[model samples]
Target: MTAHSRNTPQFYLTAPSPCPYLKGQFERKVFTHLVGDDAAQLNDLLTHGGFRRSQTIAYRPACETCRACVSVRVRVDAFEWTKAFRRNRALNADLVGLDRDATPNSEQYSLFRAYLDSRHSDGGMADMTVLDYATMVEDSHVRTRLVEYRRRGPDTAVNGRGAGPLYAVALVDHLSDGLSLVYSFYEPEHRDRGLGTHVILDHVQRARALGLPYLYLGYWVEGSAKMDYKRRFRPQEHLGPAGWELKDG
Candidate 1:
């Protein structure tokens, strides 16, 4: 066998479970643990092959009879700033995103709990405690960072850190090709600010500044209202049978 196949990670499959995004449908996943020295490189390969990283595990949909989940990545350099995107940016101009180590804190947990309660109360992670949140942020074996967004203060220019209450948080993984958005949450009360769109727009800027080509946005499922917003970011590449194909407006 070749070196590529020799180092190939072992994968396992999960039993069928109720689909979170679709009604009356079941979902299964093929997953593998991302660990050891080759974790980062392996992660990049699997991600390009349509896997999503969650803590130390990398998984992709392996439903028996369904193929609704599709992986997507933004073409940062080619992304156009639409009028709606500009509006979101303008609305969230007062916020500053501070990149920090993947260490969890009580304040972040408070915001996480509030967000889950208000938005995803019936979702899978609704019962996640503070410890679960910590594990989610710190269990990663690859390069990871937490971007905390807060309202800018007078000292922001001097310290380069946001002040006041946390407005949103994004757990991101730095890959060789681009930034992978693992998970993000925002203050539910601030929904009017369009924090979700702002987070993605900020990541596009970050990818451009870092000279990366794509911003991995995980899986986008058709017929899922929660995932419909991902389609708004134009000029993205969708992973398909023939490989990544550009989907422009």
Candidate 2:
């Protein structure tokens, strides 16, 4: 029998759109729905095959004339922090991350808006309202969580979590094999602290503690400066024609 006959996913291709990662290129995506009781399992399988989830949709690049985008996942067990990464971690020591259920809140919206205004002011999500932010966080059917980062408060030692002003937030998806970093945003003024890199490092540590083998970093498009930092997570695997292969420095 065919995979679809076994209730496996049916894929569909999206219409061409202006590429968000690179200028002067059109992009298309082949996607499948994540729904029903099997959504979690299906999402895991698809993600392993180099797909990324957005709400209930699992998609990957299917551009006709370009192949710049490549899916990347760090091998958690073998990952080692470089000197720069260590410095970034140390610089953000005052920040604490807390993982909570995938629910929307005004605080998250406020930070998200500031992040967009600072970093992605001319990007597509610049005009997103609170309701749009809420949908981005809570519309998913698969297992998801919101990781909040804030300044460490005096009471953190007793509470074991931050209780100060929010600084960053990441929308994460839990898969059987690994954790997918769906999206993340942080305070723009704190750019010098490398809060973005710190968050990914924290997730890598969290995955190791959870016994998960990989931390999916999503697509890394070649020639895109915005995605260049992803390569810093050494001993990472990139999805290619032969499946996941380790990329050498």
Q: What's the lDDT for all of these models?
A: 0.94, 0.91
Q: After superposition, how far is residue 33 of candidate 1 from its true place, in Å?
A: 0.5
Candidate 2 deviation (Cα RMSD): 2.2
Task: Give one digit per residue, the lDDT tens place, for model 1 in 1-249.
Answer: 645444568899999999999999999999999988889999999999999999889999999889999999999998989999999999999999999999999999999999999999999999999999999999988999999999999999998899989999999999999999999999999879999899999999999999999999998899999998899997899999999999864
C-alpha RMSD (angstroms) for model 1: 2.3
TM-score, prediction 1: 0.96
Best by lDDT: 1
lDDT of 2 by residue, 167-239 (tens): 7899999889789999999988887888889889999999999999999999999999999999999789999
Scanning candidate 1 in windows of ten residues, the lowest lDDT window is 1-10
Q: Each model's TM-score, in the order given?
A: 0.96, 0.95
lDDT value, candidate 2, whole model = 0.91
